[model samples]
Target: MPTATADVLDELVRASALLTEANSVTRLIAAMVEQANDITRSDLAAFYLRTDHSEEVSFKLSYRRGRLDSPKELATNGELVEFLEESEESVVLLERKNSPFNELLLDSNSASGVALPLVTGRSLLGVLIVNSREERFYGRARLQFLDSLARIAAGVLNNAQLYRELQEHARQIEELQRYQENVFSSMTNLLVTTDESGRVHYFNRAAAERFALDEARVGLTLKDIFGKGLTKDVFKTIDTVEQNGQTVLGLEGIYKTDEIDIDYSLNIAPLQGKRGRHEGLTLIFTDQTAESRLKQEMKVVSEERRLIKDMFSSYLSEDIVKLLVENPDLVKPGGGARNATVFFADIAGYTNFSEGKDPASIVKILNEFFEEAEPIIRRHRGYLDKYIGDCIMAVFGVPVDAGEEDTVHAVTCALELQMLVNSPRRTFFRGEAEHLRIQIGMHTGPVVAGNLGGSRRMDFTEIGDTVNVAARLEGVAVAGEIIITENTRQHLGDRFSLEERKPVEVKGKKKPIKIFNVIGIDQQSA
Candidate 1:
C-alpha cells in the first residue's frame, strides 16, 4: 500500500475501535464524525440521526465537528434527509454548483462533498456527511474509504443507541420511586406495612410517634408494638381483609402511654403484588385522640347547658342564661363572702289551709302561689333560690353584678309579691286561697353564696347568719306586711316608706334586731 493509503487504512481501524469502545452514542458519534472529517480532509463533517420514520423528515441527534451549535436548520432541509432515507444511497457533489443539497449549506465553504446513509440491517439510522473547500477532493479511492468506515460503524452505533435508551428509562424509574417515597413519608397519618407472618416491615415518621416506636421497631411483630389484647384486634382486622379482599375500616383502638391515652381509627388493606396476589397487609392509622376528647368535652358542655336551661328556664331570663353560660366560673362550685340582701316570703295561715286539702291539692296550691311570685323575683334580678313548701327564698347579688341597688330590688320584689297575691283575678281552690296572705322579710349582711350540693345535684343558694335573720324576720311579720332589718334599711336609701317597729329579739342574735315595715315604694322614688 502507498503511504497515504496506509494512513487511511490505519485511520479506519482507529475509527472502528472508537465506535465499538464508546459506551455512549454521543461520544461515539462525535469521535466518529471528527475522524471521518480528518481522513477525508474536509472542512466540515456532521452526523444527523433520523428521529421518526414519517413523511416529515426530522432529525433528533445532530453533531458537527468543532461547532457546538445544533444542526436543526440543516436537518429541516427536507430534500436532503429525504434523499438519504429514501434512496439509501450516497450523494456526491463535485463542484460548487446548483443543487438542493448545496443550497441547504449556503454558508459553507464547501465546493465538493459526499453524503452516505449509516444503514444497518435494512434500518436507516442516520446520515454522515463530509464537505471540502477543494473541488473533487473525495475521488473514487477517498469515497471508498469513507464508505468502508460507515460500514464498520453502523452496527456499533445501533447497539450504543439501545444502551442509551435503556439507561434513560432506568433513570426515569428511579426518579419516580423517589417521588413516591417522599409522598408516603410526608403524610401525618400513621402508615406501616407488615409481612405475611405479621412482622413489621415499614414504618413512617407518624407511625413512630403514634406507636412510640422508632426505626429499631421495624422488625418487630404485631404483638411487640401492641400487647396481646390490641394485637388480637389487629390480627382479626387483617384476617378479615385477607379473606375476601374486604377493607376493614373505622376500627378504633386505644393505645395508652405514660403521658396520655391515644384514641385512633384504623384501616387495614391487603398489600398486593403486580399479579394481584396478597403479599402482606397495609395498616393506616389516623390519630383521633384530640378529636375524640373535643367531642366528649362538647358533650359535657352541651349537657350542662341543657341542665342550666331546664332548671332556670321557667323563671330566669334568656339574658341571665347567656351570662351564666359565657362566664361559667361564676356558677362553678365555689362560694365567696360578699355583702348581699336575702328575701323570704311565705303564705300566712298555711297550716290551717292545708288540713283538709289532699296532698296533690296542697302541691297545686303551692305551685300556683310560687308561679305567681317567681317572675317578680327574677324581674328584680334576684335569683329565686328554692321553694320550701309554700315559702319562697330569693338571693340578690350572686352569679352576676347586682350593683348598689340590690337592697332596693329585694324590698321592691317583696312589695310586688304582696300585690300579686292581693290581685282579685288571681284565684286558687275557687277563692279559698283568696284569704291567703303573704309575709315578706329581707335583710342585708355578709353571706356566702354559691352552688352547694354533691356533683350529681347542686343548688345555688346563700348560707350565713343573714339568711337566718331574714327567715326569722318573716316569722315575726304580720299578714300582708313587709319587714326588713337595720342592715337592709340602711341600703334602702329613702326608696321606700318605712314603719319603724319596736325592737324585737330574734334567734341567732346577741341583741334585739331593729326592724322596719316597708309600706310601699315612696311616690317620689317610684
Candidate 2:
C-alpha cells in the first residue's frame, strides 16, 4: 500500500479498534467529540446522535456547548431548525445575516460554524454541530472534513448504537421472553434454525430461555454449546437444519439439563436472500418436562427459576464482548432482579502443571481441560462464567436463571468434578504430571449479577457472598473431590448421599464452615 494509503488504513483500523473496544458510551463520548473537535481544530464540538423516533433523543450527546440537548427543540425554533429540517438535503453553513447561531452572538462576526445532519445513508440518524470562534473558518475543506468525520462518526455511532441496541433488544427479549418462557416453558416447546456450520442464528424464546442459551444464537458455533453429551444428535440436527428440505418440529427427546428430560419441537424455517441459496433456518423446541411444568407453575420452585446468562466472549475478543454486553443500556441504567446460583470451578494443580510445561503445552492443556470440563459445567444450567488460573469460575443462575433445585443442580455439578479429571480426553503426562487433577467447589445463594467492569476491561461475573464462598472453596478443594458447604448439602437433602467433613476455617471468616464430601449412591451420608 502507498504511504498515505497505509496511514489511512492504520487509522481506520485504529478507529475500528477504538469503536469496538468501547464497552460504555461514556468512555468514547468525550473522546469521540473531542476527536472531532481536534480534527477540525474547532474550539467546540458537539454530537447528538439519533435515538428512536419517538424519543427524539440522540444516542449520543444531546447538547454540547449550549442550546437544547436535541435538535427537535431547535427544529421548533426559527432558523437553525429550518436549515436542518426544511432546507434541501445539502450541507448548509450560514453567515451572520441568515444563521441563527450567528444571530445569537452579539459579536456575530467573531465566529463561523458548520452544522451537518447526522445521517447514515438516506435515513436521518441525527445531527452534528461544530463551532469555531473565528469567522469564515468553515470552508469546503473544513466542511468536507467535518462531513467525513460525521460520516465516520455516524457509521461508528450507528454501529455502536445498533450493537448496543441489539444488546438492549436482546435483554428486553430475554426479559419478556423469560416471562413467556415460564408461562409457555411448561407447555410451549423450543425450536431453533441455523446454517450448516451450526451457527445458531435464530431460536425461539423457549429454545434460549429454557436451555440457558448465551446469546441470540447467531454468530456462535453450536459446538460451543452442544459439543458435549449429544454429539451425534448435534450433528444430526445441524444436517437436518442444513438440508433445508423438511420442517422438523420435534425430534426424539434429548437431555436438556442434567436432570430435566426434554425434547425439541425443531422447526427449520429457511430464510433465503435474493438468491434461492439457503440463508438460514429457525429452530423451535417443545419441552417434554417428564412431569408437566404446568402443574408445577402454581407451586413455587425451591430455587429461583431465573437462570444466569451473559453474552459469550471467547468467540470475540474482550473488547467487542464488552460492547455487546454494555451497549443495550446506553440510554438507560439497570432495572431487573434476578436470582441465580453462582458456580466457581478450577483445576487444583494447574499452576504446578503450568510450571512444569512449556507455554504452548500449558495453553494446550488449559484448552484441553476447558474443552473437557466445560460441558459438565453446562449440564446443570450452569454457565462457564470465566476461567481463572487453573480454575473455572461459573454461575448457575444469572445471565438467565435456574428455576428448581439450583442448589441441587450446583451440588450435582460439584460432584461431577472427578469425572472431568478422569475423562480419557484429559491427557496427563507420566510421573509428577500424573498427580495433576481437577477440583470443584460450589455454594448457593442469591446475588445481584449483571454485566460488570468497565470499557478498557470488563467481565461478566456474579458477585455476592455465595460467589466468594464458592471461589474460596474451589481453592481449598482437594483433587478429584467436590467440596460444598452445609448450605449446599441441605439443598441436595435426601436426593444424594453426602459425607460430612470437619469444619474448616476459611479466609475472612468468623466461624468454621462444615464441609461435605459427595460420596456414591451406595455410600452412607454419615
Q: Pick the candidate with the highest TM-score.
A: 1
State, as a TM-score between 0 and 1, how close model 1 is to the true structure: 0.49
C-alpha local distance difference test of each model: 0.78, 0.59
Candidate 1 lowest-lDDT run of ten: 66-75
Q: In candidate 1, which residue ranges exceed 4 Å CA deviation?
A: 1-9, 20-26, 49-57, 66-72, 75-77, 96-109, 119-125, 151-164, 195-199, 219-229, 256-261, 293-526
lDDT of 1 by residue, 1-526 (tens): 2137777688778778877877788888887887787766677787877676566656554778733232444455568767876777888888888787773342366677788888877788888877777787778767877888887778788888888888999999999988877877798788989886678988877777767778888878876776633656667667778787787889888767575467788888888888887777888888897667778999988887776667566656578877877666666566777778988898888988889778987888888777767777888888888888878888887756576688888888888888877777775534566688889888898888776778898867789999999999989998899999889998888788999999899987889989999999899976
Give candidate 2 misplaced runs (Cα > 4 Å). Answer: 1-310, 313-338, 424-432, 456-458, 521-526
Query: Whose lDDT is greatest here?
Result: 1
Structural similarity to truth (TM-score) of each candidate: 0.49, 0.36
lDDT of 2 by residue, 208-256 (tens): 6666675654677666666653447656765665675565554555655
Q: What lDDT score goes with residue 449 in model 2?
A: 60
- Look at candidate 1 and give me any clashing residue pairs: none
